[model samples]
Target: MRNPQRLNVPIQLDRDLPEPLHDQLAAQLRRAIARGQLAGRMPSTRTLAGVLGISRGVALAAYEVLLAEGRITGRHGSGTYVSGTGSAPVGAGSLPVRASDVVVDLRSDRPSTQAFPLAAWRAAWRRASHQAPPVEEPPPAGLPALRAAVAAYLRESRGLVLDGHEVVVTAGYADALALILRARHGAGRALIALEDPAPPALRHALARLGTVLPLPTDASGARPDLVPAGCDVVAVLPERGVLGARMPTERRRALAAWARESGGLVLEPAFDGLFNPSLTPRPSVLALGDADSTAMVGSFCDLLTPTLRLSFAVVPRRPAGAVEEGLHGQPSVTCQLAVADLLASGCVARRAERLSVLYGAKRAFVRQVLGAYPDTRLLGGDTGAAAALLLPAAVRAESVVGALLARRVRVADLAAFCHESGVRENGIAFSYGHLDAGLLSGALHALTGTLDDHRLPRRSAA
Candidate 1:
């Protein structure tokens, strides 16, 4: 067949940006390739390089990433071409590309729907349906049976011994947190300290409740000594999601002591223990600190699925109860009861075990790929569904993130997590919690490609 006319794919390179020139080239080419603009054959490295005013090595690097991702291929000498069959031509007559259609999200908050134990969940719901339905509005604190079950699950899974009455169910972490702040401070503004590099969404949510002081942190997670005087509450993620920081026993001890000495409340978002039969979690700050001065928020989103939005708060015993005096969003009794049954029947535990193995494999892939890169370091590995990589100083996390996102792989810069804008960091975070193994692998490779784009282009020895 005669070669199709060489297409005019608009490839722009801006050198002023922190994102590398090769990365910029790769992103535009990938976009064109996906649209079949480079359907049958692509320009040779030297030709494209000369045309674009970039080095041959730069063109070669872009091609290598696309090749690894199998988006394009090379014959013995015929140049690179799109790999898949039935690729549509770019431009008019072609379907318009929707933003949502092409994004491969790397944010790791949601778990896999396929991995959720559907059979067991359905069975639990069926059992819940068998029980007599409540005529009155269910208690905002949760159904008595569920509270008992939550307390039992906590004791079994987290080693935190508590009474059924102490577990107050809410719609999820947001509700649980809102209720906690209102109950303790009664809707009045209070001083709140949040971990530095906390999720921007969380910071916004807490901002309305009180002044949010950004608490600086290191590899060990949030610094306890920096809690600031008159701070009413300190929020920490024991799992330390994206930062990949694990609070050591000493750090936990120091936090517990801070809460004790200051009589301040410590808010810990506690995911349940690693479901692996062999692995039990270490003590939580809530478990180690004065229980009356600490509360641990728990969510089932990761344990089951975020769709089942039931979450609970293990309130400090000193409070008579977690009073949601004005709150109306307690989760449906059916969800609460069904999850309770899932826990009691060990369905949640079994699901945890399966997920442990699955996520372990995915996390290891992240470790092997991003971690193997000479200058990239993985952080906060022990507790959360998320993992963060600390990139070398030469590469800006924001630049790498932007370049990858342009290539259609959506990953986050640590700067994006800041409450205020324009903070720079050398770290980026992605999830192993609920993402597919394949999607996670591809995103990491694209990340590697973007990082490699920063290297000085190799020139011909001849």
Candidate 2:
């Protein structure tokens, strides 16, 4: 056993100082622990009292107070020691196991089904199913009526006027992007410039096709003024995922100008725009510049349902041929016709409006819950169902995410979306889609408890 004097905690008790002896000792001990002076095994109550010239009961009372607060623990015949104070530095390996019996998931990427227009969608599908079955092959571009409806809806909603001929229906965003790249791939080697922190799957797809150069984006989702001079295609997300920020108008014009000057193509994926209905909608890059320079890609998976697997790209007259050459097969005629009816009957527009209102409220509530904790900031909840939470500097996002998962609250770390290394924002994206109030509250509580567990000071570096 260590000597009583070597206990090292400075305890100066003044009986005439009005404050009780035990309270004063406990306060000082708390300070010592906070300052890393007191750790591991502490001197026994008898030894501490003898060293400080205090009664044994007074020393015991002080130790009992610290024990009650979980600052110290006593093991039978082993003496008391500092407890509930983490001594190991936070890291990926030290994180909790990601399995639990509790059930609450906050992983970002889940879609909100609360506001789905089931009645309208069923009615549209019924109408499409009732139509006389045609034995003709699906058109190379898409069903004529569907293309026309998409064009009309785009004009009315996003202010992007395009002929039905410009619309090419595809399976989804991936299919649409692949078609664009194939059409834009001219004689020489194909090089593409993409924004950093983009969709991981899309980046992987681009890497498989050709060389991809990453362009950094600013706080508002605008790319830097300069890009590689020789790239044939420049793909941008108007509503960037993870970050949940949008590109500025001036930046949009710059991108269009680059595409026009370099004789390249700008593929703008307006996935978020599908559900986000604004009074003054932001015109797509296709509308901002000449049709030859830009193509707009959209997906129905954002609004209706992901399983529907319907998407389209609006291209210029010249590249319309490229889409035809690249596309292997057409989308399902029945699904296309159903969506067409939705667009033509204004059901899509009305549904988008209702979704905007419904999700807007849910997003606000989620932000409120996440914002209640100190040292946390929310990044993207503008147009998507997910929001990125910036954590405290000392906190590692993966560790917290893992901790939450161990308690059955699943969330994804933002670093998972990056293409390169050394990115250290320490954020996790939480998706509040389709989560009811009770589930959300429970998840938040679990997250809170996990964070609380990490509040103790970790072991210092060697």
Candidate 3:
């Protein structure tokens, strides 16, 4: 009667229960086996009794009950085997039902999925599918033609000087970052220093494999000095610093220096960098002749629709081969094909240009609405895509959020971006990218009314 070596149950039995220990153990084991935990194996009655500190007679009695119930079958020489009843049935649904459906979804980060260029995408996909040779092989680090097109697009539109060979297509910015991190530093020893108030998705991804050091950020952006000296990598949002403004050139140079000095890697996420119509495009850290120390990453999803999951990373010249090898080792071919189709079709580039103009107008409209409410203080002044509004200190952001939700107006609280525990100032971050003029106007009106009802003071005109 040896104990079942294969069985791994998570429950801890309570000896003080009024129910007999053997009955309790039997009931728990039955449920565990029924739930597929004790599949294909049976523990010996003697071993079970020894482990549970129960009498051998009690263990034999429990085994008799289980045997009668057809939970296990004893082979002649070998120990008992778990019967068919011991394992749970497969293919069961276990999803929860929602009580009330959400009407407005403002929490998403990308443009509406319905607005995706489906017709153009389908035509391009069909064209690619047909032209693609049967028994397809993975594209040379993503379709060569697409790479060339991206190179040309970046050079002309983004002020980046890149060759097709330098660009490697990725599923999205998140995937690109993961691949680059994996390549430069093996899955182990990859420590990424992230901004304290960073995108939750990116933070979660980095946290899964690497040590994450949360560096504090302010209006200027992530302070490079705060980054731990020994960190192997650093992730920075160049376009939208901590408070959502462009990181100054001086700070960029300092970060470059940090990477160079420490033999560290820098992942520069150029989010919404192309949308800035006012400022000259800042050179990417990877493109700053420090390709050995930095990787430039960007995504088309924000400019186009989220369905177009095309992103690219320009690795340092020396590490390009290692990065490509690491990428191929990982499973990401489907995403590469989809991105290639989108890029080759020229739909994403065209849509991005159109969206630039549309979002520009929307940004202007939001500004006008902010202007109407003289008390509101606009943070991240002249930022192209998203704007932050600071409400009076007296107004409760949670109350304002609830009121806006009641009016079917969706917006995000600035406090959600805070990393530390304390009473944060009242503010809201508004993205004009997906909003239309009417919706933007309505939301502004609701926000103004909410502020007025709370009797919050307005910022005085400078």
Candidate 4:
């Protein structure tokens, strides 16, 4: 921790500004501490109120915002201290996970449903139920409050800066992709480029468009330069993933630039809270480049649960027209408002940060257990609910999966994720999201034991 010291800087606040005074003060403080203008210890709320000639409530509120973001911490007896340096970029995006049940689900996409905020969700649902009835059908663009809330969630939690006008609510991820495809014009089968080895749902969505050529990727995520020439649309998860790799900030910029230069659209997940909040946030692709050609599409499946079908996309200049023209069917108003309440109040961000930390611990366990096995290579990138291990060339993935299933432990084959040939290599996926600590450890042991027996057939030998 930095040495505790007093804040020494001039804080300017304009009362006439449309933004709230507390918000203004919070913004200035956030920037100041991040840029080393005034950091370490800060004055008490009462002291700040007097010093700045503002109400005590305003000062307290400003501190609360920073505290929520983990940018500042208030010592019980001591003053507030800077907790962050603001050197990392804020990121937004999500990778959709596929789910099923087993004694131990090793599938790469399952979320920890146990951690689902049932209490908070119940409260939000009740609040939504009490809202005033809508006289007319909600707008296709989604409830205004929900849109604003989504924007705020992105800004606070994901680090992407956007507003309500940029967001369009949809049923979910596939719907967002379909809407984008329809939003396009003069399309004789919308030629599209998809990140290789993506979720089957994504592939299915693109199937409704035109031919989807696989955009090549390595352990570092998809390559923007390899996007097919003349493709009308490109979709990718800008956030990093386990074995799924991540598109770096530079790659994101290039991809965003590619969209602009090629006049194509870039579709990405709007909110993926799978990343560890303890680390520096990665910037969304849209955040790094002109959003006029890029769209960030996401849903609450990972954030809340898979049952809540609501989703949103930060629409670009072109697609914004189609979205407003009824490209989407608005979700139920009550649910929308309830979600709006959560996002607007920072509940979603707080919950996501907690879950990320929990999952990060589980991920580390998997690494520590299986990382040392022969021919087992843990995939790169520390964000995602799932973990991937590259198996020895001799171990057959299908056999391993079958063996695990027979033993009541289910896992996913990397081949299952590959749509076109050559999208991924031989590997197996393990998910700890839905699994408890004890189950996960047992599953790891079973996995290592399975790998120990050379009785399993090798590819060439098979």
Candidate 5:
């Protein structure tokens, strides 16, 4: 069999220019490689020179430049090949490269989608698609049916006695936060109070628009005393921490009272605990006598898939108009209808019940595994998708996280969540929602081994 001629790359150079011929040639080849035209094996320097009507020395020099820069590889007997730097050729049937060799994933932000009711959801979607709305544009507050369904769901499950009018639909958590900020402050720097170990995404969202005054937290959650005066908004999770710490009842009241006194608004997330059976429903800030000064955010991400991007905010009557205006576009009509069907037909509740059982068992398994290490303290499991594993003071949380990542198992470092530099809590947050029982077991085994390896040396030295 005869090999085809290797001459796909189209190179043009000017001999009249001040630039060296080799330099111009190399530059052309560089462009070709970047455009993916120069993938796979390249013609030999002698052959390339002959084809391009250039001197063999110039071609060789250009090839040397590419070689030194690690752009191409030269085999002793075989011709030069495009190095791994270039993308695979189009229609070459190259398999998609895996991002990592991750055998188990325990990343905290992810929710469980393994047991999603795909059949029922598809049925709902089909039904929604068939029933087209008379109007193409959805109402800014969402479809009337979805808004009513959301209000009813919250009222029944969370004990909020709110009407459907209070429910404002949003694209997601980020969109909800953006709307809240815009409606309240309207393009000014607002100092917001945030829990020390708040969700990184929330902190990141507020970073540009506001100055975050860190509220230090203990076992019972964010300390009310530490909430600085003059901040306009204080963000917290309803009766819980971002990673599942149960806030004491007194503390919750105290925080609400602080908001009342300071004339600051409270933004409580009721996002993650919908399916947590262990947690008894407490009075939300809206119900606990701070309804006027609080805005509660929740999402279907915990109930369904994150990519669905459906969320709602219980906005007070005062800023209701502005918040509605800020929500410029409506959520997808089909999604709103499907969710409405799920909520109305009680499909969501049934799924939540099953998830409640699964997550409870998974949480217990995690606690049991972490219990083997006496120095490690389990902080929160009352609600939410993840639990915090507080480590001894000396163990660097980032180092252990790095070790686990090296073994292709990922977990969140508790330190990364803290907004304040002075706070030095060390730990990992394990999200068990996404992983199945078998993978969760394997992840725990690897996590325990990594923790042990890091701990033994410090113990011996001390």
Candidate 6:
């Protein structure tokens, strides 16, 4: 087939240009699309790369930026084409700007939907369906086999020892948190502490039932002193270590000690636990010396398919009865069955291993690109999954976020995560796992450009 006239894009790369070749290509393409210069069908990555005298990877990276932005769409076996208009392209703008619009979301906590192992999942589902039991009801807690597999996997990977019966499966992390809250604090209003800059969904979920307090963190993990005296339930991200320093052993011990003294329950939401490749694996609070007050919970949504709403919480033996009683009223038959098959097929384990490496590479790439902005600092860079860029205090985070959105770069501001006065920080969180190098570079360039264009001059210098 002949190339479409409108799809004939000429990307000029200057050797002297400080920007990377892939980023330059991506930015130019974005400009073309915005100006209606490149319309309808687009060229294949190979053709575009060959025409522009660049590597296929470079061309592909550029294409990924467009894809991430929803400027283009891929047809199986066919070439890429310009996406239809009406809704703004993905990453076209920040969250608030595109509040009602379905933008291609780069700020999502979930893994990239495109990279999901659909074939493996489908095969597993088919096999499980054929081997379906006479009854449609899920196993009491979950499919026993799946629970056992999860236990084994966690033991091997995360070093958490658990019996299959101890693992209670739920719809997702949200549901699991709800169940845990209900189990631990039935009718009583407990003071719950969470990270200051936490995932908004978590804050909303916890706020609905209890007095949610935002716990502050510096280079170390959540400060044990910051955890209010009256609070009995503290929710924390287990590995929120700063740049070079891991969460100190002393700090963890201190937190445990505090929990012990206060009679508080420590709920560790181990988000993206599987993706870390550090030599000394970050231990879960639940794994610390058989503490009866701590429970470790993990969600497969961020690591696997978000649509597959299966999460597990390793409850302390003390709370087992409470958890069981709380979950008795909820119906989760289909969810358990699907999760069981997913575990039995070994697809989750395999994919998780692969994604760990994939996300690590993407995280490194994003850091390399975003590192160009001297004024910006990356939070959680050592963790190799999600990082937040801390902008200068003078910069308007919300406006900058909106500007990025207009350019199709989706990101979340720290303001959304803050609670009460004197806790505001000028920053935004970026999930590197969901984005590739090319898209990341392009987005960074656009974001920096927007910030530069709008940033106020230093008052001292002025």
Q: Write the per-residue lDDT of candidate 4 for residues 1-462, one digit (tens) a residue.
A: 122134565578789965467767876676565444654467788888877788998887788767765778867766677773222222233221111222555664655543345557768989999968887878878888898788777777667776322777887777766666666643468887888777666778778778888888886788898988889888787675436576778888888789878888787777554557666667777776665677777888777767778887777655334566536476788889889988876778776866777678777887676655645677743667676777777777888888787667888887776766555668887666766455677687778778766453322322
Candidate with top lDDT is 5
Report lDDT (CA) for all predictions. Answer: 0.70, 0.70, 0.64, 0.70, 0.73, 0.66
Give the per-residue lDDT of model 1 (tens digit) for 1-462: 122136476777778954456656766676665554566567788888877778887778777756755778777755666775323444465444453356777764766443345557768899888878777778867888888888887777778876322778888677788777877888698798888888776778788789898777777778898877899899886555347665777878888898888888888876733433444456888878876678877888777766677888778654444375746677777777888898889987777777777666666677666654666777755444577777778778878788888878877777777646324567788765644444566667677788778662323343
The positional error of residue 271 in candidate 6, measured at the CA in angstroms, is: 3.9
Superior candidate under lDDT, 5 versus 6: 5
What local lDDT score does residue 143 receive in model 3, on the 0 to 100 scale? Answer: 63
| Count of clashes, each model | 4, 1, 1, 7, 0, 9
| Structure candidate 4, residue pairs in collision | 91-282, 93-272, 94-272, 112-433, 268-297, 269-297, 270-297
Instruction: Please report the TM-score between candidate 2 and the true structure.
Output: 0.72
Every model: Cα RMSD to truth: 13.3, 19.3, 19.8, 16.6, 16.2, 7.4
Considering TM-score, which of the candidate structures 3 and 4 is the better prediction for this target?
A: 4
Candidate 2 vs 4: which has more TM-score: 4
lDDT over C-alpha atoms for residue 188 of model 6: 72
For 155-184, candidate 2 gives per-residue lDDT tens digits of 787677674228888877777777766766
The better candidate by TM-score, 1 or 5, is: 5
Model 6 per-residue lDDT tens digits across residues 1-462: 233244555557776854457657776776566555665567778777666677898878777767766878887866677666323333444222222232435576657433455557666666666654645556446667767777777776677776422777765676677666776788676689886666777789888768898788777757778887689788776565312224666777777777778888888765544466654665666766345678767777766656666777677554334555555432355455556667666777777766777667766776666666667777676664677778887777897889888877788887776776427778887665665444566666776678668753322322
Candidate 2 segments exceeding 4 Å error: 1-103, 163-165, 186-189, 273-280, 319-322, 421-424, 456-462
The residue ranges of model 4 lying beyond 4 angstroms of the native Cα positions read 1-102, 163-165, 186-188, 318-321, 324-328, 455-462
Error of 4 at 185 (Å): 3.4
- Range of the 10 consecutive residues with the lowest summed lDDT in candidate 5: 94-103
lDDT digits (tens) for residues 110-132 of candidate 3: 55222345557656666656544
Alpha carbon RMSD to native, model 5: 16.2
